[model samples]
Structure formats: C-alpha cells, structure tokens
Target chain A: MDVQVYRVPMQRLIQGNGMPQESDHGVAIVGMGIVCSIGDNIVEFKESLKKGVSGITRLADRKGPKLSVDIGAEIKAFSFLDRLYRYSDIPETLLQKARHCAQRSPFAIQASVLSALEAWQDSGMVARENDPERLGVIVAGESTTQNYRYGLHAGFETDPEYLSPRYALQFLDTHQVGVLSEILTIKGEGFVVGGASASGNVGIIKAVQLIQAGIVDTCLVAGVVADLSPIELQGFVNVGAMVRGNEFQTPEQASRPFDEQHAGFVFGQASACVILQSCDVATERNATVRSTILGAAMNLDAVSTTAPSASGEARAMNEALRRGGVCASGVDYLNAHGSSSPLGDATEVEAIKQVFGDHVSKLRVNSTKGLTGHCLYSAGVVELIASVLQMEGEFIHPNKNLENPIDHKLRFSGARFEKARIALAMSNSFGFGGINSSIVFQNAC
Target chain B: MEKENIFSVVKEAIADVLPDVDTEAVSIEQNLKSLGANSIDRTEIVMSSMEKLGIKLPLVSFGGVENIEEMVDILVDA
Candidate 1:
C-alpha cells in the first residue's frame, strides 16, 4: 500500500478551523501510551522529564555470568494488564495456548499490550461510536528474538516433542502484533515492521499512510522491545556496543548524549504506542487530537550496514520537512536520535547540520535517551511523544548530564525551560540496518 | 499427608497461577474450570504445585483429571 504522507499544505493543516476537513486526508495522533524504565504513562513520563530522572540502573534479574557493565534501564513497577478492560475474547484463547507452551515468553508482548491499552483509553475511542472493521494495529521490533532460546535448548538436548504447540507462535516476529489486534479486536490490517531501532517511527509513518489513504479510521501503532537476555547482552558485548559504565559515578549518568564525555547507549526495554486517525475521524468522534503527523520519510543509509550515513539521514530530514510543508527554520525543536554511541551521535549531529544548515544554530535539540536510556525499537515513538509533550505541556526537557558540550554550535537545550512556542517539531530515528526515518508533527491549531 | 495440608499446597499453586482468584472460597472438590482456569492454566497450576511439592507430574493422569481433587489425589499418592 502506498504511504500518502505530508502532502497537505502547512497552512491548511494548522488552520484546522475546528471543523472536519471535507474528505480529510491528513492523519492526526489522537492518543499515546508508553511503559519503560522511565515512567508508565505520559503523565509520569512528563514528571520524569521535569525531574530529569534517569532510569538506567544495574540489571536485577539474570541467569549468566555478570555482564561487564551490568547496567540497564529496568522497569520496576507497573499494573498494566490489570487496569485494562477485557477488550476481546482472544486473551482467553491466547492464555489457554500459552499456558503449557514451552516457549520462553519475551517481554515485548506484555509491554506492547500495556502501551496499546493505554493509548486506546487515552483516545476514548471505545466510548464513542466507531467502526471496529476500520481499526487496525501494527507493532514492530525484534531485538529480543534471540532470547527465545529455551525451546532451542530443550529441542537440542532431546527431541522436538519437548516443544509445545505455542512454541513457534510465542517467538515469531509478527506474533506480538497479533496480540494487540486480539486484545483490541481490531479487524483491520495487522502486522509487524522491522526497521531495527527505528522500528517505532517506521510503523507510525505507515499507520499515517493507511489513515491518509482513507483505508482505516484508526491505526494502533507500536514499537516494543524485551531485549534483556544473556545472549543479547553477549552480542552487544561482542560488538562493543554496550555502554561502558565504568567511568560514570553512577549508572544513570552513563548515557550522556552529545556531550564531550560521550560513551554508548544503555540497553533498555520499553513499549510505546499511539492511536493515529484521519483528522476527520478524530474530529467526528470529538477525540482529543494530541498532535498531527504532518509528514514522515523513511530511507536506507546504504553507505554501511551498521554505520550511519549522514547524507541519507539528511535526505530523510529534508523529505519529511518538505512534505510537511514546513521550512527547516520553522522546526522549533528537534528530537535527535542521539544513541550516545561515539559514531551514531556524532554522525547524527553532522546530519542535522547538513539538513538544517543556517537553521542548525536556531534549533533547540535534546535527546530523551539521556533520561530513558536507548529503548531500541520504541526510541523513536518515545522521543516523538517527548516532542509532542513539549508542545502540550509548554516545556522541552533538558539534555541531562550535558555539562560539557560536543559542538557548542548545535543549540542543545541545557536542561532549561524554553517556554514552548514550539509550533512544529521533528523527530529522527536511525536503526542498525541503515534505516533512517524522520517524522514532522505540528501542534494542534 | 492430610487433605487439608494438600489443600494449602493446592491453594498456593493456584494462587501463583491466578493472582486475582479468591483462593479462600476455593475447595479441592471444585472444578478448575469453575475457577476460570483453562487447560493451560490447569497445567500451570499442576506444574507449579508439583514443583512446590518437589514431585514430578504424571502428565497423562493430570491431563485426564477434571477437578482440583484429582490433582490432590495424584500428589497424595506420590
């Protein structure tokens, strides 16, 4: 399906006139949900942003030799499933299937369900009349696929009889997406997106397309990861991608992005989801449109499989801004994909300079990763929410631990409240598979 | 072992599987299905209860049982 994005002129979108545009093609975000080490929902996450609380800490539960750094952004408390009203009958069937299933259940499924449920409630779509047939769900991420090794171990030691009926279903990449549709009873297109770390934005971008094309009234988009596993840890160790927390006084101080004392990203698990609907559908239902996705673009770096391509990143940025009909200077805030890895952060800064040019000095940029750690697939979604919150709450969070600057030329919001006159915001996400995605959102007029 | 002791163990195991279930009103004679448990939940209850008791579940007999009493009977025999 063609992804129709950012084609509407900026003025038409901004001057919404409080009336549903006749044949509204633009898509708006009606609700959002998130669960990570930082906070459970947007309210709590906003508080964390205000306090500049870093969620990274020592890994608590494990089953192997201690990791060299042994640090992670661990979610300690939540009552996600308990709070959600039973929205579908599939949960009963899924529970029945999984009870005896030998598959090592990954954490992303639960995380996605919680995040999606919150978004569903936040939108209040259930209270109003809506076409269930027009509701769709799309979830993406695969960082934890390696953690489903229990069945492999059992099969290798003995025979395949040890594997249960739900063994394969439990770990399939698209299985978590099905869980969301089942839980929500969304009968529309449901699938998974695999854009590596940029998975969340990629999925959201696609949902906007489906909505703009009038294919679905609402799309449940999510990016989730349950990536804390021995094998996953060892892989990061082998690649030297794990954050070196030795020099830091504390684990929370490890992920200081765009700082002179930059290291690597802390491995964190989280789920972020949003409900996207056509502006007309949202208005017709009288739902609170959090923000509108003015435009989005996804491209491959194609330079290196692992290393970032500044040219590709810049192109994506230009495309999204152009499609959104917003000028580079118009973007008041930038949610940069500052993973804090030496190469990724530096490359992203260069890409920002290349795309923004003279506007680079005018931009107030910050990386939420400094607070929440790198939440893998959900980083883009989480960061996008942070950007939206800045517009809604009248504050952009500080780049915590940014005492020393990487390039003073780039105006990093040094933990100061810039009374958000933010009319437009841009979020960038780059994944390991050379995926570059940029999304532009406009404050609801 | 007393059936009352077996009831305590069974209650604990079921509680582990279903945190929201009221174990106080539950009796060993009640059907697992009546407790809102499915086949898999029943298996989990059995496995957890056996693990707590430090005994291996006879999967065949466990599969054939329809109620909590059958589970206790298996444990008492073991």
Candidate 2:
C-alpha cells in the first residue's frame, strides 16, 4: 500500500520578519492533564515521581515458564470501562477487554475526555452551547482495532441469516479520534494522527497549526493508547523487541533507557491532553498559561521503516530549536526519546550530542520511559507533562533504572534536580517508518 | 425435562447473562426488555440459555418474544 506523505514548508511559518507575528498565529498551552501507570492525574503522577514509586509489575498469568517474561508497567486499576458506561448505556461485558485496545477505542476517548475537561477547567474556558463548533479534537494512535467487537455485533444483527452481527461490528476500522468525537460531541475538525511513536507529537503539532490557521478557536490535543492486547504483545515478541528471562523479574528493572544493560522497549498505555489557544486570545480571556509551545518540527527519514537514522533525528531536533528561535545553549533540559532499544537509544543520544555539541555536557537529560514504560503514541504527551512538571516543581525526575550510561559521550543526570529552573526544554519523539517529531516548550511566568 | 428443571436452567442462564441482575425478578410473565435486557443483553441471555439448556433454537424463533413465557414457548416448539 502506498502511503501519502504531507509536509508543511519550513519557510511558511518563518517568512518576512525574523520572528513570526505574535498575533499572526500565536498558540499557547493553557492547561495539561495526563493519566499513566505512574498516576491518574498530574498531582498523583508528580507524587509518584517524588517518592520514586515504580508502577511496573509482573503479569499474573505469566508466573509459569510458558512465557519468557511477565513484567510490564500495566494500568490495571483504571476504571475506564466505568467511564465509558457512564456516557452511554453499553453493557460492560459487551464492551469487554477488547474496548481497551488503543485502536478504535472508547477507552482512549474516556481518557481524553477526562484530561480535556481538566484542561478546560484549568483554562477557565466555559463550554458555551453556541461555541461547540469552535472546539476541535486531535487524537493520535497507530491502529483502530478497539471497535472490533462492536462492529461484529452490529454485523450479526444486520445479517442474522447469512452472517453474525457480532462478527461484523468486530471488524470495523474504528480509529481513536472517531470514538472521542462521538463521546465528546466535538463537531469541529477531528483527526487521528497515525504514525509510529511520533503520533502524539504529530497530533500536538497539527493541533497547533489548526488553531493558528484560525480553523478552530480551541483545540484538545492528546495521545492515548490501550496497550494490554495480546496481539500487541505478540507483535513485539515476534520482532524480538521484548525483554525475556530474569530481566523481567522486576518491572522497573525491565526498562533501562540509557543504561548499558538496556535490552528493549516495553509497551505501555497512557493518555494526555492539553487545551491550546492563541496567546492573545488566552490573554484577552485572562486564561492561565501552562506552557508555551515555542516551535515544533517533523521530518521523514525516507530511509527505513523501523530504524531511525541518527542524522534524521539530529536534523529534526535542530530544526525545532531553530524554528523556536533558540540556540542549543538555551535549552536547560532535554527529554530524549530514549526507548531503551539498543539502536533507537543510541541514535537519539547521537542526535542530541550532534545538535548540542559542546553544550550537550551541560544539558540535564533524562528519560521518563524508564518509569512509565514506552507508551507508544502517548509517550510524547507523557514526556511533555513530565517536562512541564520539571519546570513547575523545580525538579527533574531521575531515570530510575539507569545504572551505567550507554556511551561516555552522552550526559545523563546523576540525581534528580531539586532546583531545576529550566528555561527552555525540548522533547523528541521518533516512531517507526523513520518518522521524527521534535517540539520545544518554554516556561511561562 | 421436568418443568422445575427447565425453569432452573432458565434462571441460571439469566443469572449468567445478567450477573448483577436480580434473578428473582425474572419471571415467566416479566418482559425481558423491561427487566433491563437491551438487544445485546438479550442476545447474551439467549446464548446462555442455549448453552445451559443444551437446546439450539434459531435466533428468529424468539423475535416477537417480549417475556420469558414467549422465549420458553419458542424454545419448546423449536
């Protein structure tokens, strides 16, 4: 199948004057909310970080030798199904465990709705009945398999003689955005970003562009995934990406992002949403500003499907910094897309070193994946939330599982910073198909 | 099967399909839909009833059935 590629010219956002007009297309992040294995909300998540609580645990069924490893940072306690039923009268059993899959999922919508509500409340934006069309939603995930069961049921009902309705509903292509739009009553632009891990960053960047283009007044941007499916696990196992044997004894130890003993990335689920509005619009409304998305850039490797080239990541990072009108020296902290995979981590580190060069040594770099696990599409938003917390709390969470650095050239924070005063921070996300996305955020007073 | 045995099987099927549902409220005269049986729930009830009773009835056989009486009648005829 041929994939259609879309690109926004680098010069479009940077024409005429050196700086883009403040009002021309200024976007500000007013509020942020996230739910992950670490915590349900930002406060609880921060508390977990402060206490160094690891959410990873071994899967109960894999206690025997049938499976090689059982450790994972699973969100077993989330009442997502309850939330779904609260919105609609769907039976819990009909929805089943299949509803939690990130693809075509109602769980993603539930998470996004919760986070979006929090963001809107934080932004003090009233949900005016007339302004419904002005609200937009952009969600990111790779596939849409969550509605499989629903489709099958519908099909069986329609063709009871020839086919089972249950089988038909189970086969529909249900994207995360479709479920969210229906549940949230968002009638405006609704899009589901599809990429590898970069889907989240891509969603945020697209949301910013949409708001700036006057397409929507306010945008709910989120990345969500339900990572508990057996097929998802088997896919990673088939690719030799999951850690096995004694390494999976402890969930926290299974994911060692920048450590020399790092094996591979662990799959996990998470969701985060931010309320974004124009800076001038937010100021006029006297809304609280959480963080400013200074600049963002995405690029395609055009090389390989799974492996990201070091040069591609470096170029994307440099482009984002340049677009933000900041130098490498200005970045106080760097959130590396360190998946703990041997090649992926090495490529990200090399990219950082290449872009920052001499200043790389001075950068406070950390990978939150070691704590939360690689949350696929939701990883970018989770990392962004961590960056915001780092700035707000004046502390940088340590990479929990790191014992030894993968390379001497890359610098990793030895201990959590109690007084991190980050001025500008950059978060990097690289996904399969060589898709790379980088965004720069600045602390707003 | 005796009428008592058949009724017990039907109660068990209803209990399995509606775990949280009150089994005592489900009588032969009570409408399944009125007893909180949506289309999906009703299908599950029928499936569970078939599995428990060891009786296979065509789905259309229960189309007009509103209560357990009609369902039981259709199952007996099929």
| Fnat per model, in the order shown | 0.00, 0.00
Q: What DockQ would candidate 1 receive versus the native complex?
A: 0.12
Tens-place lDDT per residue, model 1, A292-350, is 88788999866555888889899999988877766787788899998888888889999
**Model 1 / residue A207 / CA error / Å:** 1.4
Candidate 1 Cα misplacement greater than 4 A, ranges: A1-24, A78-107, A145-169, A173-175, B1-13, B19-31, B46-78
Off by over 4 Å in 2: A1-24, A62-65, A81-130, A144-175, B1-77
Per model, how many backbone clashes are there? Answer: 1, 22
DockQ of each candidate's interface versus the true one? 0.12, 0.13
What is the C-alpha lDDT profile of model 2 across A1-445, one tens digit per residue?
1111122334445457665332333368887877778887778888877655667777645211354556677666657645434423233432342243322324555566556545545666633332667778887766644433333444457544433223343333234455545544567898778767888889888888787666777787877655445555656766777665266556778788888888988766677777788787778777778788877889998966687788999888988877676677778888889888988888888888889899877788888888888888878888888888887777778787778888776668654544567868899999888899898888876
**lDDT values of the candidates?**
0.76, 0.70
